[model samples]
Target: MRSRWGKARRVSTLEGPAFMNELQRAVASMGPRVLLFLTEEKTVNTVSELRASLPVSVLIRLPEHQRLMELMHKQGFQELAEAMAAPVPRTVRLQSSQDLPLVRGLNYPCVLKPSEKNYEYGARFKKAYKVGSAHEVDALYRKIEPVLADMVVQEWIEGADGDIYFCLQYIGGQGEVVSSFSGRKIRSWPPRIGGTASCTAAWEHAQELSDTTASFFRQVGFTGMGSMEYKRDARDGLFYMVEPTVGRTDFQEEVATVNGCNIPLAAYCHEMGQALPAMSPVSPQRVWRDEQADRWSREVSGEAVNAAALTGFPVVDAQWRWHDPLPWLDDISRRAADRIKSKFHK
Candidate 1:
């Protein structure tokens, strides 16, 4: 789709079957220079099928298929972290109701989340639940255990969203680091334990986190696109690995691009055997926010969100880009429709 800003954006609906069919057709007719971006887990299987059926390259940054599978499940991630000796939030995996009692001794104010975030399961409820007591945890487990086959109980990292840091990197076809960018979250929707709502591009804590991330990927022999999320424990001043997302572009990737590290384009170039241009040094601090989500978050949490805090820094809208406005428009339309339907039912 061509927007008024003169940029062509590729937009697709999340309907699996139709989406895959269209993607397969497009890949079949496209050349080697065309790169396929896999954004959601719903389409991972489709991408695998495309890999087998078409000669076109799909940008899955993992070093191997097994690594991708490992990162998809929460338990697998815990194991991976253990293997790498990387510090992570204290976590215990539960397979069945029988394993529920194991959490009795766990620290309170922990979180419960699905082991694997498949689209079908994610459509049902919140991404995670923060429980204060064992009773609350047990109750939540009983309610969700039947629907979600596997889950993890993680000790809550005591900190606000601003303590969260991300290191986004692109590993080339030859397994070389092409470029990297880092940022810190300023705020997030759903208050604590939520996806980033606003973040500022900065390299302040990038070195240590980036080194650890690169080491883990290199040890596992991973390639393509890699991003790792970490939270600095306010109590101890140490960063703990929260999760790693491989082979897909994240929502905040544009923040990296705007700050001089164009990861998506670098992945495309590496896949096509083209030499990547030298990356410019990390740009000055810039803020990126999803205004709609931020407003909603502030409303729900009653947290003060001051635009003046970002007055001196450059700001980028996460979704409503001048070049591509359709995504945000569509999101607003869908949210309005859902609200109207909910009111009618009530």
Candidate 2:
């Protein structure tokens, strides 16, 4: 990926023995000047484990081991929020069949989610399930409990997908805020409880959002690229923080970059001890869309997929870029293959 300094190199996933060999070769070739930024948990763990042997500095935002443990696990995150006095949905942790009865009195239409959203657990089930009543919760719990090591039942926040908002910020090693940007979701695939498909840059209610995020991170002693997802309750006008995706760049962080602050780039410069780039004044509202997912969302929701309305505002395509077209092409190819396979199986 192109950064302000230059192009960033990516290492493809490899088999165990080959990966170690490649890692040693890459480190030797690149030397100590290279900084490793890990995006996933597995990568983070691997790099951290090998940090003593590696010569290069790993640019991990959450360097504190305890903080990383708390933020990465759902139940740990709830405890962290409570300790910070931050507002989060009421959550009941279930570790075994003995605790299953806790689901009985939970508010109807609550959500059930695995406490640890690790790769294996996520692959086994969708992120979360919404149950309307106790009976439904019991049934779903019975099916998943045996397989899941940990789980939680949380109150479902009532709001449209657009009500979801994010605060993306870069905190320096000294616990200083280098850059911050906020945006609201326009829509998402899978309607509610899905990844963002369409979103826009906005500062509306940003101060409050920024305060909560900054306070939480400060308490946790976190630094580097971090983001928190929140949803504003339409009826009460209060924002409840859903969770924090600390120590990595958000998927739609480009929305913030195009708007004004380039958080990831800012973090890179901060770590390198270079002068930070001046942030552009938050410009007029800009929209970003994952075209394929946004179109699919419209179709599934039975909403008019109006092209004219999108044209009224400046739009940034999330995937398609002239400079980097291969990733988009690969996505298209994979999607096509999936569709063809489905047709044949039917």
Candidate 3:
């Protein structure tokens, strides 16, 4: 980012206090009608804190504070899902050692992930862990003690990575969906435990999933850019809602634009009370991929990635763009530098 945008334009902040100070100074200098794009949880918290004190008419994705909080954490999401009667995996909150008793009743082959999206568990843990038994969960918990303390143990939805699907929607303030799109992940890093590595638009399966996601979001009065993730349980062939990406566009949000919904354009237009921007022709056959993560998934899990199978669909590389090529170059360079640094350290 520093290479792509000069230091004068992009100031990176590592700590919370420094970030808050920079954000405040930026907002103070900015003109009226601030269009804030919040992709991180800390930014959401900061924006929530500054909403009242700001001197401009800011367009925020999360219009409702309480509803936003519910979607930000694993435990809160489970509770919201239960309240909506949505098919969700049963969760046991592991906030501390005292919460261990709750995990005993859970089904084996459960998953453990941080309750909060902004959890700082360091490099010792992956985004999540799949525990084979109660004993394994207990042992893993002991090893990671205080770090995984504020986590949630959820029932594992039995299925391959291909069974994971998502529905992206930009909703209006009245809980009405302004625009929507749907897609499915074919692979994720760490095999089944990490973020989406490769995905493609699913036209045949989009309708049902989009409806389910819209219904869930509307029921909770969510009014912003968001998506709901679902996993098809191989045992019952049911699509259980895993969680939601609320108040911000998801990482794979561009997959939707590639498929022709053009969510970012639609969202911007709607926020400004303008007519929806003219959209590109729907191309539901397009595939989107993060090359780096897909490589990691393939190498780590030996997952078969047969791209020749989808000969007709064009694949959109996440990091590389034909027009804006510098970022991709920088990414590769950074990877090379890191490799050299690691070798030197060794």
Best by lDDT: 3
Tens-place lDDT per residue, model 1, 11-130, is: 375435666666666666455555667677656645554455434444454456677778767788889888888898878888888888888888888988888775555777678889
Tell me the TM-score of model 3: 0.91
Per-residue lDDT of model 3, residues 1-346, tens digit only: 5234423344576235566567667766566666666677776766665566544556676756776887888888899889989989889988676677888898888998888764557567788899988787777787676655778889999998888999989888788888988888978887898899888887777889989998888888888888999999999988999888887779899888887789878888888878996655465377788988887877787656543253356788887887778878989999999999999999
Model 2, C-alpha of 270: deviation from truth (Å): 0.8
RMSD to true structure for each model, in Å: 3.0, 3.0, 2.5
Give the 10-residue window scoring lowest on summed lDDT in candidate 2: 1-10
Which lDDT value does model 2 have at 11?
62
Query: Compared with the true structure, what per-residue lDDT tens digits does model 2 show for residues 1-346?
Result: 4333344555666324445456667667564565555566665555544445554433455557667767878888999898878889888888876787887877777888877656676777777887788778778878887688588888888898878998998877777888888888888876787788888876777788888788888888887778899998877878998887766677788888777777777777877889998888455667888888788888988888542274355778887777877667878889999999999999
Q: Give the distance in Å from residue 133's predicted Cα in candidate 2 to where it truly belongs.
A: 1.8
Q: How high is the lDDT of residue 324 in model 1?
A: 73
Query: How do these models rank on TM-score, best leading?
Result: 3, 2, 1
Candidate 3, superposed: residue stretches over 4 Å from native: 2-8, 12-21, 24-31, 278-281, 304-312
lDDT of each: 0.75, 0.76, 0.79
Lowest-sum lDDT 10-residue window in model 1: 2-11
Kindly indicate the candidate among 2 and 3 with the higher TM-score: 3
